[model samples]
Target: MTELLDATDSQTAMLADLVDSVRAVEETIARLSAVRDGMLAIASRIAVDVARQASHPDQGDMAVRSVAAEIGAAVRASDRTIERRMDAASWLVEAFPAVWAAQGAGRISAAHAQVIADAGAHLDHALHREAYAARAVEAASVESPNRLRRIARRIAEQFQPRTVTERHRDARELRRVWVKDLDDGMAELGMLGPAVLVHGMHDRLTRMARTITLENAQATKASTEETGEPDTRTTDQLRADLLADLVLTGSPVGHDSQTGVLGKIHARVEITVPVLTLMDDDPGASGSPPAELDGRFPIDTDTARLLAGGVTGWERVLTHPITGALLAVDRYRPSDQLSRHLRARDQRCRFPGCGIAARKCDVDHTHAASHGGETCADNLAHLCRRHHMLKHHSPWHVRHRRVGDDRGEHENDDTNAGRAGDLIWTSPTGTTYIDRPPQQNAVTFTEDNPP
Candidate 1:
């Protein structure tokens, strides 16, 4: 017994030491990233300065590209990627000094600093940019990069003199859809549009997919019992099928029996509003912060109000004024109460580093229900189908850590706190990573309004 205890003690100490070493390594990497950004920023300046000194004006762009390509070869990276890095580095070091400084000091990760720089890029005035960075960097220091994105955007909106509505209107003119060719004879189709409309279109497709999935499940059960074959199409596959059918035939595959030129389709999406913003006499007035769309990004208040007015049913969610925690939600669809809460809580896939929106994810049981895992929030999470399958079919394991678990303490911080529901994922190699629930940074009332 004594030898066994000693062996366990030694193992614990070794693990603890490894954890400390990993933290140290992460800090060192952050510092190195800062140094690299500084060097890239200087390189960008040199390239631009040299190009400006050239006699031929048209050669300026080519000159810069030549410099980027030269550097890219030395770094073993692509010229286009290096050129983008140069531009990003220059913007970060020159425009958002506070964010750059934070990154250099290892107070924030490079991803955090980069997103802040990106969010504040449109703040043309030095003073306004400085003010935005000061607040954004503070948030970045504590928030995960994903949560920081939303916070940074909201912070930037406050600093911008123009209202979101004005920007939205101007941006609307540039809306478009395009296709990009891919390997394996496949292609990716993308669209850029107003946030509400884009999300609404997705929601409509999801609704149609659910309908098709239910019908397929019933048919598959009857056919499988007789013929020993089942429909193996996933929800994601169904959604894709629905999208293609709707685009090509003006209705879903089996739903083509409708009388009209196009079959009826409706979309449902959750939109959270600051009570005050919705009640404001002038929502479009400059300085009013934007409403949140699906808890992922900001949308103009005018659109939020318009949707609220036209919708037949809407849930009223009350969140804490200070902590931004969800307090209560009035039932609009009582049957979907748990699902709605999960979507709002897990704004994206629970898989570490994945940003696929939660509405599109499968509500998976962390512990297999077949093994007696209860069906509840603690046991449930939104996982993109990819990761959902990975958890079940691969050696990767996942579970919700208990409150006092030592692993839980390391992952909980004010900016990323959702400990009760956070997941501890273990890889095939026995390494573990905690994926904390993203901070529910609700759009709230701010004293500063747009000019």
Candidate 2:
């Protein structure tokens, strides 16, 4: 028992050691992958430059394709070693322009140089130069490339417009002409006009001017200068209040027929609810029964006209010839019959990855109806708008099949008769699959049934 226990303990230690080794290897691999990615970006840029240079006559027989092949071969020397080296070199060249400049100046480490080279790719030359200057001054401070990118983005956003051209135009018109009470405020505002006083002034300034009179009065406070209170009302609020006062007080010209003073101007709006009904085939049900449709639903003028079928707010009722049922407003018999037949045949969208219901789909004729295909149920299939357009415009091919033998020895089965069962979809690259009709059986019995 002791011997067996010792063996088990030894096995456990070996497994633990193995796990530790795997973890260490994984961490190393991740670090190497990150380094390799950086190098690849640099290598791609180099390849592009090399290809452009190789097109010249001076570089006869030397081509980018040949250089790329050599690089590929070197990388395969030991799984991705060359790639890692190239990626590292590329990152150094791309990120640190300042480092390269400093190298020319006989200062800065290779690692520090590489960071500048990588940063250089995304930044403008002037910005890079500025960043380099800042870095030189603050050598101990570590600069993050990500923070630099955010700063760059903020600088770009500053140039963006606060409002559109039309909005600016409207605001200018409102400030210059539509707004009133300009003359009084203009004198207090110094050289600026009344338009500037009303529109351009900040919220605090407008609020203070509105509540606090420039002149001192005989009540409560001894002097207006003694009391200090922050202006609470916004500029928009003050403007609205001022406009209300102007409208309430009659205009200087006095009320006239064209002016229509606030009190004189009168307007009225009327709203009415109409009757609605659901009609059917029976002769007795020809007209709506008072009790059946008795204002149960609120019908607007438009809906009332559609249901009642008249020129103004109602129209004549039309019935289906075969069923003798009241039809929907826009529907006519032959077209509706075709629609019903199509709905019955293709009960759901036929696309391979789609299971949309027929009610939400459009009936698509497999063969074009304009090319003499009958407008019958058998010829139609349900497809949602997106898949319908995809079928019509894209390279996907759909074939409809009614009868087919099961995948076994040939014996014509009557079980599959008359059912439009299969649809074979062929992809652009010639891959095919048989999309079976949705099974109706509650219990799906297969070859091997459970005991």
Candidate 3:
């Protein structure tokens, strides 16, 4: 194996040797991936066992949380993500033995197996699962995931015989919007719904922003900020402005007309700016230290000032003179000091991968109150509604222990100290995983130095 990596052997020997080495590595990766999938299959069985045991109140240790809680914590993955993998694994083993066999033989990768399993999931599991699996796997060998989806959809349409309108109606029932925080103080808003309706909205926005011409772009390039320039907006800029205009002011959309009704859109925005930066009075400022927006994304000092001017009666934020503790808000709906600290410290759900904003989560007792859990920071952590209920109703247990200097814990770090404390989650299966609080700090990265 070590000889395979030797460039001397590859460079001096026939090219076929190098090709063989590459194929060896690829085969090893495929086999490892297949083994992991097999483990996932075992996990799915454990989930079912835990779920069944928990459902029977007579079982002592097995009377635990939902299968998702146990397996999800054990794997340190999102509950939804684990559920999908389990569904894929279980479906392949039970309904599509041929595809699973192919995967085990390394003829198809794990991804290919999952694609085949997921594509046929909507079929009638009882009567048509075998039929669907047989058809889907035949194409799986010759097709990619995308093509498999098309093949499965075509097969499903034939077997189920649903009208296009009926399918559209069903798809509309699953419409939702979600937020994902990005690395650079930005976030993406994802909209999922009827494909045609969503795509049409984008098409309309694109058409509305198509007024920009090359001539106008050229004229604006030479124009200074001091000089009045022609409309030099790019396609994206125009589309954004159009969206803002329509939302902020109930204006009509598109060149002709749009499909949706307009209303006065009310929004709440929070920005925290350092006092000196807010006043533009900081002399040491070089690249303008960023301000916190919505307590998540960061923005330039100029953007902060602009937003500050637009809002009415901006709230003043104060910090402790020494430790930078957020001063108590005596006037702003007072609450328990510890609860406030917990809320701030846990900006979002504290579960391994759940990101529901903490403000929207329930302050859960790490140990059951009935089990003598106290209402202190160390005994508390934010769990979103689903997980909060999950912890209590199932066998999942949460424990918190200090990991760093107790005296140096930040004021907002109380619920768990963003990184100071270790929160251990024990699955029904008796596996433990730790969740670290989210914090922001500067990091430096340098590429390999050239020779």
CA lDDT scores, all candidates in order:
0.74, 0.45, 0.65
What TM-score does structure 2 among the candidates reach?
0.27
Q: Write the per-residue lDDT of candidate 1 for residues 1-451, one digit (tens) a residue.
A: 5764656777989988999999788777888999999998888777678767865365455555555645654454555677788889888999988888888888888899889988987788999999999999889878899999999999999889887788779889989998654543245799999999999988998888888778878887667366655657787887888888768656555645546434565455667767667888775473444577666666667778898899777776666665566655676556577777777778788866566779889999988899999888889999887667657654567888656655433332234344477787665545555677666645444346211
* Model 2, span 1-451: residue lDDT tens: 5764656777989988999998566545534544554555555566557656756442422232223323443333321344445556555435543444443342443443444443333344555445653453234124334444444334333332343454445546544323222331111122333454546545544665556442223332555564655445565656655654555653545546565565564332111121223333332244332211111112233443343453223222333333323333323333465564443334457665454556678888777789877655556778877567656654566666654534322212224332354665554445554444443211222346421
Cα TM-score of candidate 1: 0.48
Off by over 4 Å in 2: 1-348, 404-419, 441-451
Candidate 1 runs further than 4 Å off: 1-9, 55-59, 170-191, 217-230, 245-451
Q: Using TM-score, give the best candidate's number.
A: 3
Ranking by lDDT: 1, 3, 2
Q: Clashing residue pairs in candidate 1, if any?
A: 287-449, 287-450
RMSD of candidate 2 to true structure, Å? 21.9
Cα lDDT of candidate 3 equals 0.65
lDDT of residue 68 for candidate 3: 54
Instruction: Score residue 283 of candidate 1 by CA lDDT.
Output: 59
